[model samples]
Target: MFQTSSALIRNVHSQVADRVGTSIVRGDIGVGETLPSEMQICQMMDVSRTVVREAIRTLTGKGLVESRPKSGTRVRPPQQWNQLDPDVLRWRLETSDMDSYLAKLFQLRCAVEPAAAALAAISAGQDDLTLIRTAYEGMAAAKVNEKFVAADIAFHQAIYFATRNEFFWPIAQMFDVTLRQSFTIAARGSHRARALVEHNAVLEAIATRNAEGAREATNVLLKNSADDLVRIRGREFASRPKA
Candidate 1:
């Protein structure tokens, strides 16, 4: 009974946090705007003050809001947000303009991935190579989207780990959700075969310990990914209904 009640409280806490977080991200609660008072929130949400406080703490940890002694809690500017947070990433993707968001995301990937690939070529150990190769084989053998995406993430993540750079590891982790979404879009229609060849080019270059070749091959792979997204976006736009 105690455990069940505790679980119910946790659920309510999460629901409150998600509601407030989504509101802040969607600009319904604009930056610098103070949130409702704790007591007010408790009344509105039909939860205890403790739950509202916990929910506020949750949002604050995500860099969504800041509370002062007397002035209350206010939403922070977008620049202050923890963009890599899974909830923040999901909310932004759900609310923002897709074209602009994807373009900026790909730009970040283009800048970072090639350098990481080059470093991996220089630093990868035998085990690192084996892991990357295994991931590539999995990708090659995948017969469905779910399997392909899992292997694809593992393939890039292995390269990041192979770089042996502590800073690069978080980047590998950050790409999980975004890559899943991007790969799903890129794989639409008949692009998977070409994507596999592009991925193989990068893998081959890295395996040969050719730093410059790996960098160049990674660039080629990223460019093709961006192009695939563009083509798919265009097709989506063309197929939309006109009023």
Candidate 2:
């Protein structure tokens, strides 16, 4: 039936959007390149014009592309893209030509998380302490199941919450997820043990009620993260992505 309903064709749009997104994110479609026309998309994906329209809508929301009456669709510059959206962040990180974005992520982590650790040391009460300790235990126990990465992230998030500031929470989760996912894909677990020791230092500082110590410990931890980024990306950036 020639129905106007979109539900039946929604998956087509989603698949179309994802394929284009992968291209953009992976730099198959470099910045400022005008995307193929709707008819071209129809040929490429074997979908109706309606599906192309909806797929473009999805890309627009992601800050990945823009459309004009004359220009059709153009890929936006990285500066114009959304960084806070997790998918956008992941796409940018995965497709980035330079390590600049990765460096920035570590820089932000270094700037904010250490201060949060200091705050957590001063602000946490018994309940907060329990949460923090549990997070720590999760990390320690992670080696048994090789889930240390998630446990490590939980430990940091708990510490962020213990600071009595809600804002640091998202940053904590975002950086943690991005970094852990990258490590999982990139074979970069080389520095995991160093991070664990650094984490322990932060927890011990909190247990001792030493705010500055907590700050320093977290600073060292983030520094380790930054160092790993530098080392890994240096090798990855040494060669250009295959044409």
Candidate 3:
């Protein structure tokens, strides 16, 4: 009976997370809206308070909601969200936060990745360099152009691995997916040839152990990504259906 109850509790937690996350993403529970009280949620979902509490904790970790002593749980403002959390990132992508989110993502990259590349150039050992090179070569040899884009992503991932720092790796992994999507969209935009050139420039700098060059190359790569977003946004807004 204990085991059965535990399994039932787990199922309840998962269901609540899905429904709550969906509600938050769908704007049904807008930022700053108070979530249903524990008792209210328990009655609504027909679960015990323990299950509801656990689910709220899960959402809090993902930056979807927050709990205060007297105020109870409220949907967090965007500023308080764990933007680095993979689930949060996935939610943003699903909610089409791409335009606003991508800009900040580039801002974040500008602050981190170029410096990481420079560190890799100076400190990366044989395996580290090999990882970087392998990803670059994959980009170059990809039969499908889209696969080439994935290779480019792998190259940056290797650079993060070379940093040998735990704090940075997860953010690196999270953003890398969005970065790849952004790249594919941007690489198809106005400066395809130049974008490829920028990618090759980054690879050459890493291969040659030129730290300064690697940093600059990454900066150029991210700048182009931001530029491409501007173009993409313009086209999207132009085509958005009128209310």
- Using lDDT as the measure, the top candidate is 1
Candidate 1: count the clashes: 0
- Candidate 3 ranges beyond 4 A from true positions: 1-12, 25-27, 30-32, 42-51, 68-71, 190-193, 231-243
Question: Which scores higher on TM-score, 2 or 3?
Answer: 3
Give all candidates' CA lDDT scores: 0.83, 0.73, 0.74
Which residues of candidate 2, in runs, are more than 4 Å off? 1-11, 97-104, 122-128, 163-166, 182-197, 204-210, 225-243
Structure candidate 1, residue pairs in collision: none
Instruction: Quote model 2's TM-score.
Output: 0.72
Residue-wise C-alpha lDDT for candidate 2, range 1-243, written one tens digit per residue: 011221224467877876787678777788999999999988877899999999999889989899999878999996787666666665665656445555555567777888998999998878888877887777767654347766666777788888888777777667564767544433355766666677789998987889999999887877666556557666643233233
Model 3 lDDT per residue over 1-243, tens place: 001111123377877776677668657788988998889888887889999999899999888898999998999877787777755666566666555656666767889999988877787788988888788778667767688777877877888888777776886688554676676766566565576678778767877889999999999888777767778767552343322
**Sorted by lDDT, highest first, which candidate order results?**
1, 3, 2
Provide the clash count, candidate 2.
0
Report backbone clashes per prediction. 0, 0, 0
What's model 3's lDDT at 77? 78
**Per-model TM-score versus the true fold:** 0.88, 0.72, 0.76
RMSD vs true structure, all candidates: 5.6, 6.5, 6.4
Candidate 1 per-residue lDDT, tens place, 67-180, comes to: 999999999998998988877877777666676677777778888999999999999999999999999999899998888888999999999999999888877887776677
| lDDT at residue 148 of model 3 (Cα atoms) | 71
Ranking by TM-score: 1, 3, 2
